[model samples]
Structures are given as structure tokens and as C-alpha cells.
Target: MTTNAIVTTPAIQRLATARAAVVKAAAAAQAAHDAHSNLLVKLADAQARADESLSDFRSGKIDEATSALRKAIADADAKDLQKMINDSAENLAQLNDASNGAMLAEANAKVAELYEQRVEEGSRLEAIISEIESKLLDAVVERYRVQAEIDPDSLKWMKIYKPSPALDELVRRGRVPGF
Candidate 1:
């Protein structure tokens, strides 16, 4: 009923809000991925070192000393590797423990879930935006159609931008019944 108002303004506002959320989610997701990736790298390095240590210990003390040295070294260096693995396994649920180097899994999972949800929301926003754009174009064309009907000056102007000659020819032929 209000001719002056652009009907798509509210949707555009909603789109801005949605875009902000998407940006935030994407950023958090990237940060989480970076952290998880770093922890994994650390775990990998620790595992390699532990493997080499265990291998050296095993090779050097292969006889009667094998069992005792294996036990001692495994107890000491094994703890380090185990702790690293556990740290890598930590997730958002272990946030408190994570702060102290105990959990990465929970944070990784939560952020990944958030990322998925925000991406879906962003997709919905994109769909609605596309719909609004399409309808707005239709409204513009209808406005031009109506103006071209009554005003010869508008008809002349419309002719210049006609995508094809059909609409222009219809207007040129004068306002007929169906048209």
C-alpha cells in the first residue's frame, strides 16, 4: 500500500545480520581448525620422538636388559606421548582441562558444528536474497511497463532498454485489450 517504501529493505537488513553471523562463525571455525592442526603436529612430532627412543632402547638392550630398560623408558617417555595423545583427543566438553593442555577434541567438534550450522543459515540467506533480487527486477519491469503505457516519453525511453522488441512493439501498437 505504501508506494514510497522499498519492500525488500527488511530482508536486506536480515541479510546483513545473517552475513555478520556467517563471518563470525567462519572466523571461529578457522581458529579452531588452526589450533587442532597445531596440536596434531605436536602429537605427531612427539610420537616420532617416542618411537625413536623406544627403538633405540630396544636395539641397545636386546638381551636380559631388554625387559627392564623397556619398562623404565616406557614409563618415562611413554607418559609424554600418552599425554600428548590425550591432549589431542580433548574437545569442548573438556574446556577447563583444555586450558591446562588436556582437551582439543571438544573444542574442535563444537566449532565444526557451529561452522556447519552457520553455513546452512548463510545458504538460506543467499536463497532469500536471490528471491528478493528476482522479485525486485520483476517490480521494476512492471513499473516500466505501466509508465510506458500512458506516457509517450516513457515509451520512447523504454524502447532504448528493451531486452527484446516484443514489449516495445506491444506498447508501440497502443494499449490493446490483453496487453
Candidate 2:
């Protein structure tokens, strides 16, 4: 083979490898973005569910037995008794003594518990998504570093060959010949 062909072979191989790395990094970034989007959707859905549950509890739409069960469990494990009482049965009773205040309290407590759990889950998912985003960024930076290492001159060429937006528009409009 000619000297030019011999030299070009390794260059071509390096270019292909760099291109593949870029494609892989792009795919990974896209997947991470998709996961982040899904987590946002989940967070919204959890919030909506929490709101609906709270509304149902307040409106006496939840069953009495279920509400009582929830209250008993939550109250037994509660750290802030005054807050729990204020947020639960006592609060409801104060609002309307004739209403099923105890049941409503239990239901409200349960709704709050579920809402907190969902928020925690959303927080964990957000952290994971953040980690994935960081990893994607690192991967891209590493790929660029590797490419620069393999072909230092390419960076100089890129700096010199910056595209002109006006020229690009003219080319697209068939007013300038495109190369």
C-alpha cells in the first residue's frame, strides 16, 4: 500500500472510533433525559393523588373504618403528638363537632403519610436522575478529551472552519452554492 493509504487507515479507524463514542454518549444522554422526564411525570401523578386523597378525607368521602385504621396506625408511630392531633381528629372535630371528625382525621393522616412517601420517592428518583446527567456529561467530556488526544490538529481545524449562519441560510435558500 502507498504511504498515504497506510497513514490514512489508522486515521480513518480513529475517526470511526471517535464517532461511535459520540453516538454512544448521545444515546446514553437521551436515555437519562427520558428517565428524568418519566420521574417528573411520576412526581406530578403522586402529587395529584395526594391532593385527591386529602380532598376526599376533608369531604367525608373516605370510609369511616379505613380512616380509623389509618389514624390508629399513624398516631401510634407519630413523633409530634400535638401536630398529629392538630392535623388529624382534633382538628376535624374543632371544625365540625357533628361530623365524623375522628375518621376524617385518620384519613387525613393517611393521605399525609402517602404524600410524604411519594415525595421521598420522588426525591430519590431526582437524585438518581441527577447522577445519570452528571455521568452523561462526564462521558461526553472524556470522549472529547480522547478525540483531542488522538488528533490534536482536528481542534485547530474546527476553530478555523466555523460556519456562518448567514451563509448557511443563503445556501439553504439556493442563493449560494453549497459545498
Candidate 3:
């Protein structure tokens, strides 16, 4: 019986372990993201139900029961947001912990394989996060632009105007009039 030395290396074992760990972590993160999406849907549904209750109450279709249910739904939505935030926080912590372990495994594993997997997964998640951030920024900018077109005071509140210190100095120096 001939034993192949190439198949028994400690480095090979570590590389296999690292690959498994990376796959597991990605699966966990995907699951958490799915859960977050589900919670968001639930929160939206609760909000919609609350709105319906308010409309019914306003229309006199129901009594205090509608207001009570609306309040309960609002509370549930708030709790759902908190739960989503907590879940994200916990998942991030777990990812951080797993990453640290994976780094340790890299020392014992095939460097190229470890590095390649890490970079691929990191870049994939980074792309997802970047897309989400861009969407959020676009929405905020759109909202601000619309508000500016409607009411300039919203922009003023957002401090998108000239610096306060410079304006203050100008006002103090009588270069500008105080309104």
C-alpha cells in the first residue's frame, strides 16, 4: 500500500478547514440578511395595519378598539426595528469573530487559497453594502432636493447652506443684515 504524502499535509487540512469556515460564515450571513428582510416586511405590514386602523377610526367605522390596535401595531413595529438592529449587531459580531478565527487558520493553511477566498467574499459583501449605501444616499439626496424645491427651510435645517461661523462673522461685521 503506497501512502501519498501530498494528501496528508497539515497545510492541506487547514486549507480545507478554512474553506469550510468561510462557506459557513457566508451561509450564516446570508441567513441573517434574509431574516432582516423578513422582519422589515413584517414591520411594513404592521405599519400598514396601523394606518388602516387610523383611517377606520377617523371614518368612525370603529371605536376606541381601532385606536388601541393601531397603538399596539405601532409598538410592534418599533420593536421589530429594534430586533432587526440587534440581529444585525449580533451577526456582525459573529462575522468578526469568525474572521479572526479564519485569519488564524490562514497561518496554517495554503496562503493563496485563504487569501483568494477572503478577498472574494470580502469584495462581494463590500459590493452589497456599497450598493445599499448608495441607494440610501440617493434617497436622502432626493428627499432633500424635493424638500428644497418645496420648502427651503428643510435645507436650512440640514445645514446645507454656508457655514454658521462665517455667516455669524459676516453678521457681526455688518456685512450682512440679521433677519
On lDDT, the leading prediction is: 3
Relative to the true structure, candidate 3 reaches a TM of 0.47
Instruction: Compute the lDDT for candidate 2.
Output: 0.56
Task: Write one digit per residue (lDDT tens) for candidate 1, span 63-151.
Answer: 54664555566455556656755664564324434333312433444455566668878999999978976896787777778877767
**Per-residue lDDT tens digits of candidate 2, residues 1-179?**
65654433433454455555555555555555555555445545545555555556778989666555555554443434334434544433433432334345445555665666688789999999789768966776676677689887666644434346765576477565455
* lDDT of every model, 2 decimals: 0.58, 0.56, 0.73
Candidate achieving the largest TM-score: 3
**Model 3, runs deviating above 4 Å:** 1-6, 96-108, 112-179
Indicate whether candidate 2 or candidate 3 has the larger TM-score: 3
Clashes of each: 9, 0, 0
Model 3, 107-138: lDDT tens digits are 55777556767887899999997897689667
At residue 172, candidate 2 shows an lDDT of 77
